[model samples]
Target: MAQKRDYYEVLGVDKNATEDQIKKAYRTIAIKYHPDRNPGNKEAEEKFKEAAEAYDVLHDPQKRQQYDQFGFSGPGMGGFGDFGASMNMDDIFSMFGDIFGGRAGFGGFGGSGTRGRQQHRGSDLRLKVRLSLDEIAHGVTKKFKVRKDITCSHCHGTGAEAGSSSEQCPTCHGSGVITHTTQSIFGMMQTQGVCPTCGGEGTVIKNKCKHCGGTGVEKGEEVVEIKIPAGVAEGMVVNVPGKGNAGKRKGVNGDIQVFIEEEPNDTFIRDDNDLIYNLLLDFPTAALGGEVEIPTIEGSKLKVKMEPGTQPGKTLRLRGKGLPAVQGYGRGNGDLVVNVSVYVPKTLSREEKSAIEQFRQSDNFKGDAATKHTIFQKFKNYFS
Candidate 1:
């Protein structure tokens, strides 16, 4: 296989760039040098393909992180590395997303995030759920039905026959390599290639399984339960490890992602960590000052004291509310802001009109104050 290039450098971005920044960078260059835009131009095509590959990896949180840790020599460095390099122009497979865990990267998301050098892992899956504001306030448990490949119960993850066993390959002497001549940058040199007979798999099964057909796996349906934490917000993703497809070999299963989506609230809007809602107050009550009851995320009433002369759109805060921190810090609580909406009367009864007239007759009324300005008197005398 061909060696790969640094993903961060290929995208022309810093390693610390955020997801949005990565997306913007990729879009700008991808549009400019896109294969469609610059058709038949090999260089532009390469650049466009490279940008797409970068986007594929960078858009997914997990893959970008893995790519970050391993520049060009990581476990999956060569997985989709060829697409970014355009090594194989005629190959267009399913999304790398289809491979890894439903997250698409370059050529394909064919592998998993391995802590150390080991066998491959199955794909990961993503599932989205929408919840009401009240559901987000407290915690909830959700059950999911999923279909994935699982280790064959008959074979028990081994492809060998039940009575017989697997023996190491002999052509490559279990090392799975043979000597061959190849042309390199230096010159024609002798190198080791995979054993043609054994396919370089090292081990060969003497008797294959009849049920799994030597694949060591089968497709099945299963149900999984997820715990939605308190204070979870929309657009946030939760990772459930090792819940994806079973590996063909001894490789591990992938992960499952639960994406939280909040249903639009009729009464409130949520900002990052804060809650905003509207409260209506009558004109008299706003001017005279009074207490009011309001709805809260907790499903209980919150009592608030409205200040005298509280203006429309004025905001008041209630502490210790909002979504919980997903990081388990237990230190984040959002403030709830109540927007004051003064209810103006458009039509009034005779009794209400009489009360207003009597109020206009009080000292608070300013009917003749407009004509009693004294600064104008001094200026008038000077002018006369």
Candidate 2:
């Protein structure tokens, strides 16, 4: 066997390429060489698998670092062996379903062949799920009901009554396709189409099912539970295989696409994975340092220390206290940015007025000439 090509060369990217760049390159290669697009072409299929393997390694930071440092014989090279000969079509499509807009399968190349008699796979179902900031920070499971077509219990997906079964189509002789010959000016041409008698199903039901009227599916509601991953952004889709509408006449069921919708937080604003929290501090606390307890996304109170004479626009960072990375190897948690705002008193009591008058008259309130001049210049700039 020939030695495998370098991963970066296979993906057509540099060693310093970002994750998005690597993924985009792989997507282009995979789509161009997809088996469905180039049917029965062994070279295209091999190229597709090679691109998948390259993406699998380069998109991960740990694997990319190891590959860079130690080459292919690195310590973490367990699954980085021969690429093309190992994976089947299903494995490749299912693993990278996200790149294809949450859809996976190899059926685009359709004609009169062994696959003709098989029923088409059901259509995929999409629904939105709204999650709170806490739920996004930590993964959560959500349950909801959806109305779709399910296999008929009475017919068992055969579209026939309990005692009888489906009969082979007479028009196409169970091939589900009809061929027609036409005479043109140059020569004779043959065209293929679905059999009118069987409607491409290749079977006819004599005793139709009572519940679904020979369709083999019934209107039903199913409660599906989806386990949402942590750090999923809004509009990201989570696919659940075999949870969608049932296929017609024993075909494969489709997938359930769950779209993420993050609810707006009342106290915190999310920016990517990081969370921003605005903290209001009194004038005394700003002048004299104090400890303030703030709430975290994980339902914990964290005491933050304010420095003396802290500015109103000052930001305090709490590292690794935010959402986790959604895909691949985690890039670690984000930060909780605390933005301080000083609150000024609108009204004061008699005791407060007396104290302010005393402080104004004190010697400590009077500064040197240069300091006063600098203060006056700053005030003038602010007004100007």
In model 1, state the lDDT of residue 359: 88
lDDT of 1 at 343: 96
lDDT of 1 by residue, 355-375 (tens): 999988776544355444654
lDDT of 1: 0.69
Candidate 2 per-residue lDDT, tens place, 89-171, comes to 54455456567643433553132122255465777899899998889988999988989999988887888888987789889
Clashing pairs in 1: 96-108, 96-109, 97-103, 97-104, 100-109, 100-124, 101-124, 231-323, 231-324
Quantify all predictions' global Cα lDDT against the true fold: 0.69, 0.80
* Winning model by lDDT: 2
Misplaced by over 4 Å in model 2 are 1-105, 108-115, 180-191, 360-384
**Candidate maximizing TM-score:** 2
